[model samples]
Target: MKSTVADEMCTEDLGNVLPSVYKSVRLSVASPPLLHVNASLLLLTDEALSEVFGAVVEDSEEYQTLKVLRKGGITSILFSRPHHANVLDMKMVEELTTALHSARLDPTTRLTVTAATGRVYCGGHKPGLDAASGLQLRDGLHSLVKCVLEFPKPLAALVMGPCVGVLAGLLPLYDVVLAAKGACFQTTVVESGETPCGCCTYTYPRLMGHARAAHMLLLGHELECGEAQRSGLVTEVLPTTAFHHTALSTLHPLTATPPPALSHTKQLMRQPLLNPLTSVHGSAIMTNTTQVISMARYFAAGVKRNSDNAP
Candidate 1:
């Protein structure tokens, strides 16, 4: 049903009236992201959609590409731009870095979970990588990946759908990854090319074998939930119907574990991967910068030559 409310009505009137019908969701943004009855819901019924989350979660801070939500000890970093397939643009990379940073600093935050709003969990990085934009993307991704690897608290991913592109590579790095039965995981862009994908190069090989990692990195083989779980990239394969409920239930146990034991175990587990990932990450950035800058110069020279010979 369509209910159009005036400006004053959205904040005040909606809040008072929402309790009964939308008891599970509450939205407080100036431009309400959605109302469950919102227009986008009509368009995205087939896709993985973010419900108005009030019933399932609570207390959120909205940013350009994310919603940092809190429910008790868990801080859920949600990719909020489902319409755009939740691609990792510069804005998203930066917000992810910021959210991770905040989580790292918050003493009360016992665990962190990453989930996206769309059917395509992440469509990967935004396309078109010029020198100017590419460097920002590189650095932003640098910070974001490092933040994920270095994150002291538990880092989890609830994959309700496909995770493709660079993001597909990063999944192996998360502490506990849970994928819905329908989910697929794999990278597409770096396909055997000299794509300086630093993180995945180190991560996938270590988790799975080098041969399998090579296949994943070069061939873009999609791993179904069971395959991913067997590969050890995912901790569990959850049934789609009960995924949200089961995924949340599985994580609640982590909170009950002693904080120090969790902390030390996380630290010990990540320690070995840190330095290698950093070295690989830095090398990829250097390679990409060199390629992008050289290509820029070559194109510039050709443009100048064309102008000089102009009629």
Candidate 2:
């Protein structure tokens, strides 16, 4: 088979890069294990772990918002623009959509993970762009959300900090969400005078129940890591010190599973949501696009007023 971008990116053998990390620890069922060392320490030292995870396979050439990293059977899409707190701009959305589509087509890819490298996972859409730009932004975001929803492989998120706005809205789409102690989640669309996009209207209620989903979407309630896990929005919460190791452990299981079986299982599990998700997706995009255009006007007018009043 011809190598796709994902296949090309993941060509480096992880086994060669970190031999010690790839070795399995032996445990005897009947007797105490010979080694008394900490299991976490045996996997990889922090420095080695960082080298493995932080290795960038594809830098943002067209899309400055994120980078793609591949190791073993896993492909990680990291939101790279921490300067804007990894905010989702139109360009970012388009880039993400293209990446997702590429991953979908790659047979070598078994699992996909989305993460952020800053204090925020995603800060929602950028503001103050023109109405036409806002519409393009909506279209781009809608396509990205659709890609995530219909992704064949299991998708996971490692949230290390505050996950706000559209990023929070995407939690339910992920098969698993590992959050750090400092991580928090909020859906800000309704509070911002916009309806929820990303099929959040359907996904949230299914994952967290109508009441809690209502609290988040309608009342703008922010869930701390503990609350998010309790509400079923987060799969696990780890201390900042342990978050990376724990996230690796969580995704390690999927590497063992056959890709075709895992993909089919994911498809079966998401089958129930597909119809409703499709039904709501179009309207959600339309409503959000209209609201974005209007909100842009409001933001521009406020900026003009401030400028006029100054000095």
Candidate 3:
């Protein structure tokens, strides 16, 4: 069957390419053992953890913003443009959406992991968000989030640094969010006086409670690795040591679970949320696009006035 455990799980152990995130923290903290250490992600040929330093890549093609690495039952989508802090521009968002859709259709794919290069997981929306590009950005992000919400296979995020704005809000929605000890999360939509998109208003409150969600979105309160974990956002916090091996090891258990079980469970759990989140994303996109674009114009004008006065 498509969901057979043997057919869906990773074939090899994960200790080869990755490193430990926190050397002092034990992987076996929970009673039942949170990590099984059997999974390895073909994130990169080398799993080049140093790529987390933001290697400068000249943007050239459709693959510039991110790259896809596939092996066995797992597909890893790495945000490749660390030089830009892995910002989800229209291209990035749309590309990600396409990748998710592809993964959903691929019978061989049992899992999809989204990891970022450099110090940031996702730097948020486009930097120069303006009225002209607002609709495009909104549409792209709306599509991306919708893909994630409906993804049948397991979805994981390898977060290393600052997970901000739209992505900060997205962590709560992923099946697993593995974070480095230094990773931080912050929702910035309200900071710009924009409505929260990516189903954040609906999801965050459900995961962490309304007060905490309001604190995060309304006040832009940042949650460090510990806080995020305590608040139930992160699945695991890793030490900063083993670059690739240690982090990927936690996913070994994914290979143990039957594919159908995971898929069915996810569908069942997310079924109730599907409609609400879809509705929220649609309505929020309209408000988010317009309000954020207007705010961007205001900030730009303010910057111009300050610059002119300086001269």
The worst-scoring run of ten residues by lDDT in candidate 2 lies at 22-31
Model 2 TM-score?
0.78
Better candidate number, 2 or 3, judged by lDDT: 2
lDDT of 1: 0.65
Error of 1 at 127 (Å): 3.6
Better of 1 and 3 by lDDT: 3
- Candidate number that wins on TM-score, 1 or 2: 2
Runs with alpha carbons beyond 4 Å of true place in candidate 1: 1-62, 191-198, 294-311
Q: Predictions ranked by lDDT, top down?
A: 2, 3, 1
Error of 3 at 164 (Å): 0.6
What are the Cα lDDT values of the candidates? Answer: 0.65, 0.69, 0.67
Best model number under TM-score: 2
Q: Write the per-residue lDDT of candidate 3 for residues 115-226, one digit (tens) a residue.
A: 8654446666664456667766777777777788778889988886667777777766789989876777777645446676768888888888999989887877777789
Candidate 1: residue 108 lDDT (0-100): 78
What candidate 3 gets wrong by more than 4 Å, as runs, is 1-61, 127-129, 292-311
Task: Give per-residue CA lDDT, model 1, range 1-311, as digits (tens).
Answer: 44533222222333333212122121221122222223332223212223422224323443767766666677877776656556678888888889889888987788888877544466566633456876777678777877776878888898866566666777777788988766776664443233636388877888789988887777656676687888888898876554556787889888788878998998898788778888888887777667657666666788889999999
Q: What value of lDDT does candidate 2 attain over all alpha carbons?
A: 0.69
Candidate ordering by TM-score (highest first):
2, 1, 3
